[model samples]
Target: MKITVQLFARARDLAGAEHVELDVPAPGRVADLKRSLASRFPQVSPLVPSLLVAVGTDYANDQTQLSPDVAVACFPPVSGG
Candidate 1:
């Protein structure tokens, strides 16, 4: 399944785009999504380890199960002083 992932902050800068399309497994987990994102968009690969993944508006962990029609987004952790 093809999923459109939204990018923000450093991820957006690295990917050079607001969004990216990835080939994801149906009934997938965040872990799978991360791997796909890394393989497909190596520009954002570095952030994959510490990436903040949101399935809809809530932050998702690696084991979070993903449905076919869910909104997904990823970004690097924010730290501003």
Candidate 2:
């Protein structure tokens, strides 16, 4: 299955793009997708451990299943007052 992934804040900067398309196996989970992303974009691998993932706008866990039609977003920690 293919899914559209959005990179936010520092994640976008590290990846050098706002969005990317990923091709994953059916029944893939968030963790699996993360690994794939790291492999595809080695430059950003160092940040993967601190990244947060979301599916269709909701925060998701590593085990969370991915839906083909859902939009995924990778978010890095934010700082604010």
lDDT of 2 by residue, 1-81 (tens): 888899988778878999888777889999988988898889888999988998887899999999888889998776778
Query: For candidate 1, lDDT tens digit of each residue in 1-81?
Result: 888899999899988889888888887889999999899889889889899999999999999988768899998998889
TM-score of each: 0.90, 0.91
Error of 2 at 14 (Å): 1.7
Off by over 4 Å in 1: none
Model 1 residue 10 lDDT score? 89
Off by over 4 Å in 2: none
Instruction: Judge candidate 2 against the unseen true structure and give its global Cα lDDT, from 0 to 1.
Output: 0.88
Model 1 worst lDDT window (10 residues): 19-28
